[model samples]
Target: MVETLKSWRKRWLSCGDTENLFRDNPSNQMQGVMQLKATNSGMPMKVAQRIDVSKFMSYIKVSRTQLNHIKRLKQSGDGIQTKHVSRVIGGLDKSHVKPYGALLEDEQRRLREHWLEMSCNDLPAAFEVLRERKVLMEKSIKLLGLELQQKNVSVLRKVRCDLSFNSFS
Candidate 1:
């Protein structure tokens, strides 16, 4: 299951001080943490006697207040001897897809120029594709302009109300 800070603190602190927790605690902290004892040291572990709290604090990366809080948790000794927790990674966001902007501006410009040149030279038969695209774009622009003009005329006609009332006697 996903472990939160509170749960982590509870589990870690419950391991019962660096004395009981870190003695044979080769599982969780084995990677970067200092192993104070050889599990095979054959000498049974001791706590609070040898570990200078100041030096210990440096290794654990917590403030005195936090350490005191941790000290208060019950040393329930759950999976204290158990080791190895698997990590979970979430799905990638759009940022991860093009993290560095796909290509630099100068490179992108050069690429576009190269692509245009290649298509015109190598694919001469496909010249109609470009021509068709240009034609369609021009047609869309003209249609939009005409629609805008018609809307403006209708709006103006509505705004200028010519109310000529005639009476038949």
Candidate 2:
């Protein structure tokens, strides 16, 4: 199941304030967030007793304000369901659904093998393929140049014939 900020806070906060440090950073802020390893260190609290009421009150006030705001926005709606919006919407939107079926194990293996074969696994062979492609490209370019030259010559011949004929006239 996906973890949300409220759930995460509940989970870690339930463990006690001594074990976790919630910061203002995005990963620790409102909404569902993953448990941060840095903040959620299982090590014994070094400054548990040092926590002042002012600091605790500030956190509580901030959380209460956010909760109230969200409740107002949601107004009469269920408060923050754990399921994603797409899941809640059900099959009405097929956009999230996969277009194709999952591949069979044998087909997946075959594709992997084909990809390995196509990849530059053998350097010498890959270089040879590149060289062949370069040669073919050069040959095609030369052929195109020859064809262009022939067309130019034909056009020049026609122009010369027209000039001569017009001169005689």
Candidate 3:
């Protein structure tokens, strides 16, 4: 219907659409967040709250409550990277100051301020898994070839033995 098309377009064009079509769509929300974050000033509370809800679109989605937790490290103070907000934290914190580092707990983290800015959302986890699978498949194929060769050799030996015995007979 014409109404459906209009609603769809509104959702695509602006985050403030009244129909709320994008409320459940995380990707769209992520985009809205990015746009809002890029403004010269901080985003209005309404926009920040909408982007926060997007944190739930996927299993890894980060909720609005947790947004500020990571903000401590961001230089721009815009928002967390989309992928980093996933269900799990998934890795060591990017900070260089470890527990053994000479810096105090608070001071150590500040040391990583620059690195945190560099840490925004991006993921290679899934690709790394696929890479491992490819390696395993290659190894399996090689072993299968060796087994086939051994079987062929054994069969040839049996045939040769039979041929010599039949000749004598």
Q: What TM-score do all the candidates reach, one by one?
A: 0.24, 0.31, 0.29
| Number of the candidate with higher TM-score, 2 or 3 | 2
Candidate 2: lDDT of 98?
Answer: 26
Ranking by TM-score: 2, 3, 1
Clashing residue pairs for model 2: 4-32, 5-31, 5-32, 5-33
TM-score of 1: 0.24
Model 2 misplaced regions, further than 4 Å: 1-121
Can you rank all candidates by lDDT, best first? Answer: 3, 2, 1
Count the clashes in each prediction: 0, 4, 3
> Compared with the true structure, what per-residue lDDT tens digits does model 2 show for residues 37-113?
54457667766542353234321112355456546646747755534332433343442332122223445888888
Cα deviation of 34, candidate 3, in Å: 50
- How many pairs in model 2 have backbone atoms within 3 A of each other, for residues 3 or more apart or on separate chains, i.e. clashes? 4
The model with the greater lDDT, 2 or 3, is 3
Model 2: how far residue 13 lies from native, Å: 27
Error of 3 at 102 (Å): 44
* Top model number, lDDT: 3
For each candidate in the order shown, give its overall lDDT on alpha carbons: 0.53, 0.59, 0.61
| Top-scoring candidate (TM-score) | 2
